[model samples]
Target: MNDLVLTGDRPTGPLHLGHYFGSLANRVRLQERFPMYVLIADYQVITDRDVPGEIRRHTTELLLDYLAVGIDPAKVTIFQHSAIPELNQLLLPFLSLVSVAELRRNPTVKDEIAHSSQSAVSGLMFTYPVHQAADILFCKGTLVPVGRDQLPHVEVTRLVARRFNERYGEVFPLPEALLGEQPLLRGLDGGKMSKSRGNAIPLSATEDETAALIRRAVTDPDRVITYDEERRPGVAGLLTLAGLCLGRSPGELAEEIGDGGAATLKRVTTEAVNEFLRPIRKRRAELGAGDVRRILAEGNARARERAVRTLEEVRVAMGF
Candidate 1:
């Protein structure tokens, strides 16, 4: 069998279009070819001191988004990170292999700290890369599907795996990143698409909600619509979104909408987006709470089985 593939998302909010185009779509294809493990990274959410109530509520929402996007639990093992205690046990040994200064210097961690509203960084926040390493290695993950920005986190996982094997003899396989061809979709405000920014259109969003969000999306003040990301990010973002929905190039969409103006662009974009999301929203509405609970229960059990085996091997190798 091919090396196992591992990836996940923090259940902070409902999954959005950025996630659908960026990774979720790729995951739907990958699960058919590889032994894949998709994690609901609940533990990682608390790194920023998020309330437990919110995490619990959003976890269910995130799962529904996964199913709505066609992430079949039968094909991919969708598991909760915190459900596997062995994953936490692996974190201690992995943390020892890396230094504090190195963790502080991780670009991804630094970016999170800079953008966060917190005045002070939590130790959990600082050490999340270690936790992520644990999440991957606990599954013996040899291939990690991630975005370009997340390459650094995967690199840290490789470093941890290499150091552990060097000191204790070979055990973990160093995981490589598989980046998707899809471009990173920007938020409605022409920035990173995040729920915290209130700029994302959730996969579960109604047709009216999607239309309202796209109507208010930032666009170039100039009359004509064009696709120049460097000079006119707002217009370019709308074009990119429309292209993703309609299966055309942003440049092609730009030319098609030439001299149509921002109002025209927004109108086309709103229609394209709502049309694209119509089916996903319908499927999500069809899923009952019982369906989500049953999926999680089965996934958590399968994940624990793999995690336990990996942890036992690590313990013996480390003479613990």
Candidate 2:
């Protein structure tokens, strides 16, 4: 059988261009060739439970975002984390396999703990990677597409697989990381593209709104408008967005503009982004919120079947 491929996004906000390039586009292809699962990790969202209502809205919105971007339910499973309790059940033994030092060393968890407002980080937060490992392994996923920052999670998953097999029986495969080619697309302010940062162009944003966001995107202060990732990261970022949207190389775009001011760069970037978003906006409207739920409902049933089987095996191994 083809290797299982699994990946997903948090339900904090709408999917963005970075998501498209980083993994979703690849997922669209992988589903045709392999067993694929796209998870909307709502349970993971509780790492910061400050805004329960926002999470509720985005859980449904996340379904729309995936469908709008061409993730077909027929091609791959797309389920929310909350719907799969079996995966959560596996988290207990998996967490026992790793030490606190190992969990504390997880860079993603560390960054989250440092930035979050919570006075004390929960075990869920510290051992989040193990939960993530459960998410993948429960589906028997053998290949996980993730960003550079998430390679560490894949590593932890591999360790979990090894420990499980050594202690119990050989059941899970060691999943490999499928890293993408795109540069890490920073937000408008040049920080990570995140909803809370208020820097992302929401997939649901209108053409005018998207353009306006691009206009305010930061550019290099040194050269004013040159596209040099190393020296002019800001301008290079704009070029990256335009290049990804227009299907042109960033260098080609820079050469074509030839000393264009930041305004010119922003204008072109805005136009390219607006054009790209137009179709998605229409698709999003057509799919509607109700349709999104229907698709995810179907996906959840499919995902649950596979997850239930895996958990049964896990329970038998643990003598449950």
Candidate 3:
């Protein structure tokens, strides 16, 4: 079988600029070159939260964002995580391959637990990396598109694949990380970009909303604009956003806007981001919930076919 692209987002909220620079942009580029599968990690959304929240609504919005951003359902297989039971079933055997101690060692998992406000960590959240493995291996996915922070999670997936093949038989291809070309787009406050923190700009935001959000970005109190990532990450981040949208270098953009300060920087960045999202927002407006559901239904059927076949192989490998 040929290498398949498997990558996805947790359907917790609308995607943001970080999502675009990190994975969505790459997915649009790779869809033409390879058979890509975009997963809506619906189950993973509950890994940390107490309630499922508006999963159905959030999942639909995520799908709409995918299409609006040019991830065509005709070419890319977009499937929901919970819809495929066989795929989740792989977690049982895959989980057995990993140790609780080993799970504790995953840096991403540790970071997530630390970030979560609740004192207790959910079992599903603790074993998140193994669930990630099941997400990739069940589809025989060999190329996973991810940001820098997600690399460790993929490493855990690779480990499970290697160990399972050793014992159960050669059932999975060791997947490789296709890192995003951009640097980490930190939150407006120079921390993680999350909606809960009120530091994200959703792709579906209007020009006014975009402008309003940028207005609150945390920049150092210097009245000059320069791209100093170490000392001025917040200002530098705004520059990066403008650069990505305008197709220019952040340093170059900073030089052009010398002494422009946070006001000018935010204005320029807002203009750039809104201009970049205009077409995407228009496309998003044209998408309907009906279309989203139909596309997912089709994708789920296709994904189940692939997952069922993989599980059949696993059973045979173990002489079940």
The predictions' CA RMSDs to the true structure, in order, are 1.6, 2.1, 1.8
RMSD of 2: 2.1
lDDT of 3 by residue, 91-152 (tens): 99899999999999888998998887555788988789999999999988999987788899
Model 2 residue 268 CA deviation in Å: 1.2
Ranked by TM-score, the better of candidates 1 and 2 is 1
Q: What is the descending TM-score order?
A: 1, 3, 2
Off by over 4 Å in 2: 49-53, 220-224
User: What overall lDDT, based on C-alpha atoms, would model 3 receive against the true structure?
Assistant: 0.89
- Model 1 residue runs over 4 Å out of place are 50-53
Worst lDDT run of 10 residues, candidate 3, spans 179-188
Question: On a 0 to 1 TM-score scale, where does candidate 1 land against the true structure?
Answer: 0.95
Instruction: List candidate 3 stretches off by more than 4 Å.
Output: none
Residues 104-139, model 1: lDDT tens digits: 889999988877655577888878999999999988
lDDT of each: 0.89, 0.83, 0.89
Report the C-alpha lDDT of model 2 over 204-291, residue by residue, as the tens digit: 8888788778878887544345567776777888888888889999888888877667888889899888898888889889876678
lDDT of 1: 0.89
Which candidate tops TM-score?
1
Superposed Cα deviation of residue 34, candidate 1 (Å):
0.3
